[model samples]
Target: MQLTNRSKQVSNKEMTLAEKMYLPAIVGGLAITISHFFRKKPTIQYPEVKKYLGPIYRGHHILKRDEQGRERCTACGLCAVACPAEAISMVAAERKKGEENLYREEKYAAVYEINMLRCIFCGLCEEACPKQAVYLRHDLMVPVFQERDEVIYGKDRLVENMNDRYIRVANSEVQATPTEPSLTRAAT
Candidate 1:
């Protein structure tokens, strides 16, 4: 006494010898395995062939430098706080009177370091930086490391080189110019 009209028809008929052997099911599985042999493999060979990373792909982190080649990080600790993985650490040092050309701000990061092994490359540090000093490079990726000691990147590796400046694609021309315009009083 079924109450629902959606009940499926049940087969109570005895199965044939070939049907019980499950030869059809076995043949279907074998056919699927053989068909995959002719298909293209999606594996990529590294080192010799680099993968095409998209424009927004976040890679190695960098501490940016101003147009004058002065370190822009002010040791505000905003980036360190924003890092969810707690991979970034830094020590602030007061800029000396004679080192005006080296740092953009009075306070600068003296010991900035990021553990590549712990870092998730989430780019939160870049967003949290008010000075726009911290940025994840889109063009370059962190190299393969066999030893754990090499994964920890210090200020020397994070600092942008003045001779070979890293330029963002969206602001290639803009980055080449000065960060701000000179505001002077006009002669009345």
Candidate 2:
């Protein structure tokens, strides 16, 4: 029973004396190796020079704050739910009468923690954020830690700093910092 019209074309051709010796094959491989030595070096000098990750790369998690310096996260648990690795965890707390300036909404995240060990950096938490509060910084990466406690990031480390804010602009071209001229500048 033929499965189809397909059949193997077996070559029973005899090899020449040169093909049997494999001297040409060795010479061809040597030529390739020699050519690579003359070519430009592919490795970059680490520490002194860092590779630029694309704008959409998901790195360390950050809970952003609004222009008014109020916490933007409403403690809605959306980011936690969106995290496929179950890395995000937060405890919602009601904002007090006098603490309105501290938080943007009535309900706020009192305790937010992201387990770095469990997180896959999938960027789902950033997408699920309705208030645009949670984001993964493309420039900043999560550093290696010896202790297990250091891997779990809390609100203290995740909150945005007023002096240094991570601004994600359009096109994923450039991330203009506080010192940069503009955020939406064309790739130069």
Candidate 3:
């Protein structure tokens, strides 16, 4: 069984004609191929056929405004603290005397920002907003083009028009319609 030479020796083992034919192996392979071919396709066609994302699915963040055009963000910094990715940043600003109609709380966000590229869309921002100012809309399936700075969505992009169906649902009140960001533009 051992060869004295370092060179390998050829085996004397012989295969049966049936083994050479490989009929069983071929049949089994064909059966597996057929089953796979007949199996349902699992690929989701996007754009034309968007997958039904859950209602709570996190996509983007938005700071909401009330019917009187008051900012819903209390500048609580809860979202900033909760974000694992550290994508959120905000500066608290004191609500001015007449600005009470523009701010829901005494402390409003003077500068609220979310680095979309850094955000994980974990919904923590939405959850952390005590004022319910942020929510992930089902329609936020827009494709993100690859570029140096294109992926970073700012307050302008995060904020949508009130006409959007998702915004309407969020408003959920007759008085809220007029003041919705999409419906009314804040004076620059």
Candidate 4:
């Protein structure tokens, strides 16, 4: 087998005294620096003037509730299984007879947690949820934390309040079957 040399040849011209001294290169660098000094800066005043994030931007995760104020998660473990980073974990428990008002399903998550450090914010958990119980909130971003433990979000932190604007926005997009007659009327 023969190898072909497809390389281009260049002429090696002798450098002038000024070129050899690198005076042209120095002047070129100075010209670039001076141009940048006069040019408009593309800087945002972070604290005072916030940059706007688009509507589809995914951020913090939230455990949603039904219209009746009951937890929609059935502790199916689907979210944990679907998470590529293995950031989610939950303990399942059977709902008590009197706890129907607290849980939407017979099985409920006794404990649910997500390690934010391990999460890639890919929205896989939200997509895996069949009940539409989990959502990655577009309005809220995950806050910076100093300690490792502070990044681990428990049910208390993940659960969205009924009055929360983000939760209301999320719920409005989800078409859930009305559990109550009043909710059915309101939807109509």
Candidate 5:
């Protein structure tokens, strides 16, 4: 047995000669094309005129340093472990005597690398860092490389300089706060 709903059936009737000609459809399409032709273009002259990326825009990653210009990374492997893509890898080394100027902690990352091709840049590594040593910065741009090996950033590439913008911001924040004594000022 078949069930019927008494609904109105859609007509599949053949089109008339005028409808088959599609004159209205053609005219409507041409009208749209003509309207767009006179419209103002949204094209940007890139490299000459830069678009503003708002604050909190995440870009390339950088390993941060303490106010004393010492490496903040303890080599705890938290950033590597938190990475969903498994792009991060590092080797921890014990900070030797007189190396206190170089590393903030007893253990430091002797070898730290991040594979750009593998990294999703989800900012998980930045969030997972307990020491605030790793961060995805807005200013820096990660450039394209020819070689796959070139994409894998070592400490030399990943580590930011002492006068880095992020480090300056951190220093300013610490100095601005009344409760916090500026380590950079205290050291000097």
Candidate 6:
């Protein structure tokens, strides 16, 4: 195709009076803006106030206890096996004959460590515990620090007794007699 070299007749255009003044555009914009000023602000100020966490929200790990208040973890290694991140480590020891009251099972974890840096907090380890020895709670209340090494949680940091409400609730639940068809009940 032959190019049309003749400079195409330039089309000249001018803004209409309303467009040129720019007043209508600004007024139209302000009409919508005014509605926002009177409406209640939905924005929640963070840090000043935190939102409510759900009952089962998995935030941080805690070692659980049985009704007798003994450590629930038997160190079965299932938690370590279930950990996709390999965050859990344990040294299991045999419970001597006289130590049955101290340990729930024949084996107990002499040393337990969970590298929080490596842990994704997926709650998989909690699910893997047959004795229900672990859970995540809202009391992930502590602020994290800059040091990575400090994040590794040992057994000492993991165990916690119930707080006021939890203790009352736990005790109430404890006092309630267990019904038949034992598998039907949900623990907590």
Q: Which numbered prediction scores highest in TM-score against the true structure?
A: 2
TM-score of model 2 vs. true structure: 0.77
Residue runs of model 4 more than 4 Å from their true location after superposition: 1-40, 165-188
Model 1 whole-model lDDT (C-alpha atoms): 0.81
Candidate lDDT (C-alpha), each: 0.81, 0.82, 0.66, 0.80, 0.78, 0.70
For each candidate in turn, the TM-score is: 0.69, 0.77, 0.64, 0.68, 0.69, 0.69
Q: Cα RMSD (Å) per model?
A: 12.5, 6.2, 12.4, 10.7, 11.2, 12.7
Q: List the residue pairs that clash in candidate 6.
A: none
- Order of the predicted models by lDDT, top scorer first: 2, 1, 4, 5, 6, 3
Q: Which candidate's lDDT is highest? A: 2
Superposition-based RMSD of candidate 3 using all C-alpha atoms, in angstroms:
12.4
Error of 4 at 159 (Å): 0.3
Residues 101-165 of candidate 6: C-alpha lDDT, one tens digit per residue:
66777888889998887888788987898887878654343346699778878888887564522
Candidate 2 vs candidate 5: the TM-score winner is 2
Candidate 2 residue spans exceeding 4 A from truth? 1-28, 45-48, 170-188
Cα deviation at 186, candidate 5, in Å, is: 39
Which tens-of-lDDT digit does each residue in 1-188 have in candidate 5?
44778767799899888779999879999999999999998775544443434345567888998778899999999999999999999999999999999999999999999999999879999899999999987544577689977998999988878764463243222232112223212211
Q: Is candidate 5 or candidate 6 better by lDDT?
A: 5
Indicate the worst ten consecutive residues by lDDT in candidate 6: 176-185
Off by over 4 Å in 5: 1-32, 45-50, 167-188
Q: In candidate 1, what are the lDDT values of residues 30-134, reduced to their tens digit? A: 999999989988665444444445456688788999999999999999988999999999999999998999999899988999999999999999999999999
Better-scoring candidate (lDDT), 3 or 5: 5
**Per-residue lDDT value at 103 in model 4:** 95
